[model samples]
Target: MIDVRAVNYTLQVAGRPLHILKNVSLQTKPSEVVAIVGPSGSGKTSLLMLLAGLERVTSGSLAVNGADLTALGEDDLARFRRHTMGIVFQSFHLIPSLSAIDNVGLALEIAAPELSQSQVREQASAALAAVGLAERLEHRPTALSGGEQQRVGLARAMVANPPLLLADEPTGNLDQKTGAMVIELMFNLARERGTAVVLITHDAALAARADRVLTMTQGELVEAAVTH
Candidate 1:
């Protein structure tokens, strides 16, 4: 679950403060899929970064899965993210040398230090299979296609079974059909595992698939009514 209230992010530019997020507030429940749609420079990614603990909020409160992100120190935030948050970035952040299974298994190994290497590998393999990548487990990112690479990314994110998933333009690099497939896989997996998702995307149709859609303009966020 996520609870964000009056969050603001400002950066120093040219000796003046530039506000990237303005009084943004939102909440998500477990297994809830929330989509954020916005134009370029609308601060959608900034909001995601704040939630993921990659960036600090200038003001306001953000709580994810009972952790007060706004109040935590850097070390605590990193630990929280490792144990509680799964992140999918537009650019697949896979290590070039590691195979898909290892990349995913690495996440599990990091998140659950108590797990043995064999246990991590088994869980990572399961995650890859869940995303339709059973046959490609041993393949490296360079050997995989854009969609396949993204699937590996997805598997890595979910391998830990974190309480919340944050995706930023997850399908941005893939073709339409591939993107759709990836999106479906992501939602299906999230639903099956009761993982709350906060998706940041530019595609309206993709946003429409979420349980709730929030539009951002000039750093402000407002929920949009779904039109059936």
Candidate 2:
């Protein structure tokens, strides 16, 4: 579970402070999917970064799965992320030299250096298969389509089986149908894995699939009504 209270985020630019989030408080339960929908410059990415411990909160109380990220130093935050969280970015951050399977396997290997290469490969292969990318395991990002690359990214995220999954504009680069399928696959796997998902996206239809939809405006959060 995740909880936030009076979350305020600000960035200093040109020697002046610009508020990105204003007293935003939110709580998401385990296995619950929450979509953040907002206009550009509304702090969606800021919120995701705050939750992921990538960006420090200006003023707020926040906790994820009982860890107080605000109090953690860089090393502690890195450890927490390695053990309990995974992120998918709008740009697939795949290493150019590593194939899809190797990329995912490398994540597991980094997390557990003691694991044998064979074990790492097996786990990575399972992750790719779970995301329906078994055949593309040997392909590099440049050799794969956008959807294929993103699926490989999903496999990397899922390989850890972390409790919290944060996706930033996951479908931003794909076609409508491909985006839909990718989003659907993400939600299905998150639910099955009982992973709490905080998805930042601009698509209403994709937001509709979440257990809750939150609208952001001028850095404020307004929880929307979910309709069946």
Candidate 3:
């Protein structure tokens, strides 16, 4: 449901133009997971931000779920993101002042204020339960473990049932086994929901688990070896 074609992103840093993404082209289809694997400074995260419309593209086209992302004005992109895409960043990005339920409820609240307070509670509770955090709904991020916090993030992202999910280094802070479990749970749930996923990760083994893998080097995207 996502198509990126020959896109390039450039920025000026102290009077020098920095090319962060170069002619990158990739597509993510429903029920598929695409893992982008690259080293630091390889532009994987930059490409994700561009697709999420957090960064402006200097050239080329990007379409997510049929919306032309690069063509929209900043305001339109913000609306699109709220309704169509769910993003999980490296740092959970949870609101410290809000409880876990409120954090996830914020997703639903933005879209549907008509939903009753009890309805919001019910939906938030269901989402947290889905991510194995049913009992921690009342807790804050600081009160939860690293893995639990990420699960809560996933719950928030998936609560609205967005068609596309983008995660950047989601399991970066967890132990190997914990990371694998979180990755597996996230991918499995997304697939079950028929959501397209675009993931950025440095772990090759994690990338290998995806439906397809892409590599970035010096800001250019290259395909990985195809699995038969």
* Total backbone collisions, model 2: 0
Candidate 1 Cα misplacement greater than 4 A, ranges: none
Model 2 lowest lDDT segment of ten: 106-115
Give per-residue CA lDDT, model 1, range 176-218, as digits (tens): 8999999999999999988999998888888889999999999
lDDT of 1: 0.92
What would the C-alpha RMSD of candidate 3 be, to one decimal place? 1.2
**Which digits, one per residue and each the tens of the lDDT, describe model 3 over residues 1-228?**
888899989999999999889898887787788989888998988888888889878999899889998779989998899888888877899988888999999988775678888999899899899888989999999998999888888888888888989999999988888788888988988989999898898888888888898899999998899743
What lDDT is reached at residue 135 by model 2?
Answer: 83
Q: Higher-TM-score candidate among 1 and 3?
A: 1
Clashes of 3: 0
Model 3: lDDT equals 0.88
Evaluate all candidate structures by whole-model CA lDDT and list the values in order: 0.92, 0.91, 0.88
- Residue-level lDDT of model 2, residues 83-162, one tens digit each, is 88889988888999999989999888867788898999999999999889888889988999998888888888878889
Global local distance difference test of model 2: 0.91
Error of 2 at 72 (Å): 0.6
Candidate 3's error at 9, in angstroms? Answer: 0.6
